[model samples]
Target: MGLVIIFLLVALLAIFGLVRSIKDKNLLGAFFAFGSLAVFGWFAIMTIIYNGFPVAH
Candidate 1:
């Protein structure tokens, strides 16, 4: 639902941050970004799998 969408957006931003951090050689930023990506991405995927797209009210 709405939560899944928010998680996906955050995960997408994390991907961008990961790329930027790698390009800038910022290890700490990259680490945090990667962690964010993993957590948010996992949540988004699991939510979709468990609840189905568009979800049921």
Candidate 2:
């Protein structure tokens, strides 16, 4: 759960970076940000689906 939260937070930051990079016309930065967003977002979603939030003890 904690890992999921951290992943989600990083994904959110990646989203922000993606937007900023696009506005600045920085292709490389946008690419990296997009990659980060995909990886982190996927991990967070998968974790939630597999383990369930507040995971049972």
Candidate 3:
């Protein structure tokens, strides 16, 4: 529950960052936004794998 909420918040922030980056036409900002989003996705995947896929088990 808490994880879901946190992820949701991060997602919103990431989207905001992405939009800002796009509007500013900043390559660095866009890179950061993508990197942050990738890290979040990595964490989520790791959590699922560690917890047994939440489906296989």
Candidate 4:
């Protein structure tokens, strides 16, 4: 539950960062935004692969 919320927040922030970077025409900021999003995706995928979500009760 907690980790899910954390990831959600991170994902949202990354999306916002990407949008802001693009709007500002900042290439470096865009690169960092993509990196952050990629790391969040990695964590999400690993968690799902190991736990299979909701722990099967």
Q: TM-score for every candidate vs. truth?
A: 0.93, 0.90, 0.59, 0.71
lDDT of 2: 0.95
Winning model by lDDT: 1
Please report, as a residue range, the 10-residue window in candidate 1 with the lowest summed lDDT: 48-57
lDDT of 4 by residue, 1-57 (tens): 459658757977998999999999999999999899888867876776786665433
Off by over 4 Å in 3: 41-57
Please provide, for model 2 over 1-57, each residue's C-alpha lDDT reduced to its tens digit, 9 standing for 90 to 100. Answer: 787899999999999999999999999999999999999999999988888886557
Q: Give the TM-score of candidate 2.
A: 0.90
For model 4, state the Cα shift of residue 5 in Å.
Answer: 2.3
- Backbone clash pairs for candidate 2 read none
lDDT of 3 at 19: 87
lDDT of each: 0.96, 0.95, 0.72, 0.81
Q: Sort the candidates on lDDT, descending order.
A: 1, 2, 4, 3
| lDDT at position 6, candidate 3 | 68
Mind giving the per-residue lDDT tens digits that candidate 1 earns over 1-57? Answer: 888999999999999999999999999999999999999999999999988887456
Error of 1 at 5 (Å): 0.2
- Identify the runs in model 4 with alpha carbons over 4 angstroms from their true place: 54-57
Candidate 4 clash total? 0
